[model samples]
Target: MPRRGIRSWFTVRVTTALFTIPLWLDLTAVAVGAIQGAMFAARLTERRIDLLGVALIGVIVGLGGGILRDLLLNQRPAAISDNWYLPVATAAALLGMLLLRVFTKLNGLIIALDAVTIGLFGAIGTSKALAYGVPEVPAVFVGVISAVGGSILRDVALNLPIALMHVGSLYAIAATAGTVLLVVLVSLGVNVVVAAGLCVVVTTLTRLGSVRYGWSLPEQRALGSWRVWRRA
Candidate 1:
């Protein structure tokens, strides 16, 4: 090969390897999310925890975020193109099913695991966007979406109120906050791994604290209707 050709090939190989970091991040996130999804399905006695239901929810929670993120970035989703993605997801789902059978009460574990995945996905997504030369603000949005998109899909699939739209444990807010923290740390010359670790701690602590303390964002009521009622 010509020297220039060799150099170009090497550059492409290195770049592709670096990009695989995000893929691995998403894969691990999907596994965690799948376990949590199965746990959630098990918790709902009404859902009856069918194998098919557990597997379906697992797949949704596993792949939905990355698919959406990739589409938004105008890149082909790794979850679809990568040969290992589906098998990993399915295997994780099966492991989750097995865990469900072993653990009689998994709610707390599920919540904790879900929080961890949120942080992982958020950090990875933000890093990816920044690597791709995305601006700070939009990168933050991408991070938040990558964190919460899977859970949102899970909610929709289960016919539950979408977690992002509801006054629940600060899901999107936690993701955004973590991603912002990560971006700031990276800008300050912190190592990306350290920044990601900090983000995971921040996101997990915030999410778990919100759930523990029953914290919620303030609700908006229709003051206009109340005023008319009082006048009448």
Candidate 2:
């Protein structure tokens, strides 16, 4: 009876851990973001982002989103406060820097990587916010911000135009759709892992599909610019 009871307890603990697996998504997201950041730095020779710059960008990409999300959630930013977060990010950054040269020529791969990171972060963010009992709308917003925050930081550091502000891609829209879907499903009592998987799939597909099909939001042309053009 004692041995049977111990086995049952062990099974219960393992089952609990399995259910919490979604919490680890952030780590994978950070790794992918770091790799993308390194690639971005490699591409910006004209901007003079060398090896150290690459590492800096990688670190920012890896942790920027989580920091922002934590701040918004009124929690300690794990990226800054957690020992493991820094070490993991730093190691990933160094690895990205070391691998920078080889991936420079893999055109379109960066876009794919960006899409993947967005999906991972978006799903993870929504799951976390929901777990914290955040209100539904705010949870969705958190997911969107987490999805785009790192890239915004990366662009700002590089002195590049913010990708989210542009009309060229369905970045925010994709995140919104996925996050909303996840929230809705969870509300309907879907399994968390299944919901998260679906969210990631929708986000990634929407982003990559928009890119492939040249689908973009309509640009809002400035009336003043149009008037000036007419005068000319």
Candidate closest to the true structure, highest TM-score: 2
Residues 121-200, model 1: lDDT tens digits: 88877767766656667878888888889888889889889867766559888898899998777666566667778988
lDDT of 2 by residue, 94-179 (tens): 87677777666664787787798898888877777766557678989999989988888989998889988998879899999999
What range of 10 consecutive residues in model 1 has the weakest lDDT sum? 1-10
List all candidate RMSDs to the true structure: 7.3, 8.6
Clashing pairs in 2: none
TM-score for candidate 2, please give it. 0.81
Note the Cα lDDT for every prediction shown. 0.76, 0.78
Candidate 2 lDDT at 217 equals: 74
By lDDT, the best candidate is: 2
Q: Model 2 residue 110 lDDT?
A: 70
Cα error, candidate 1, residue 229 (Å): 22
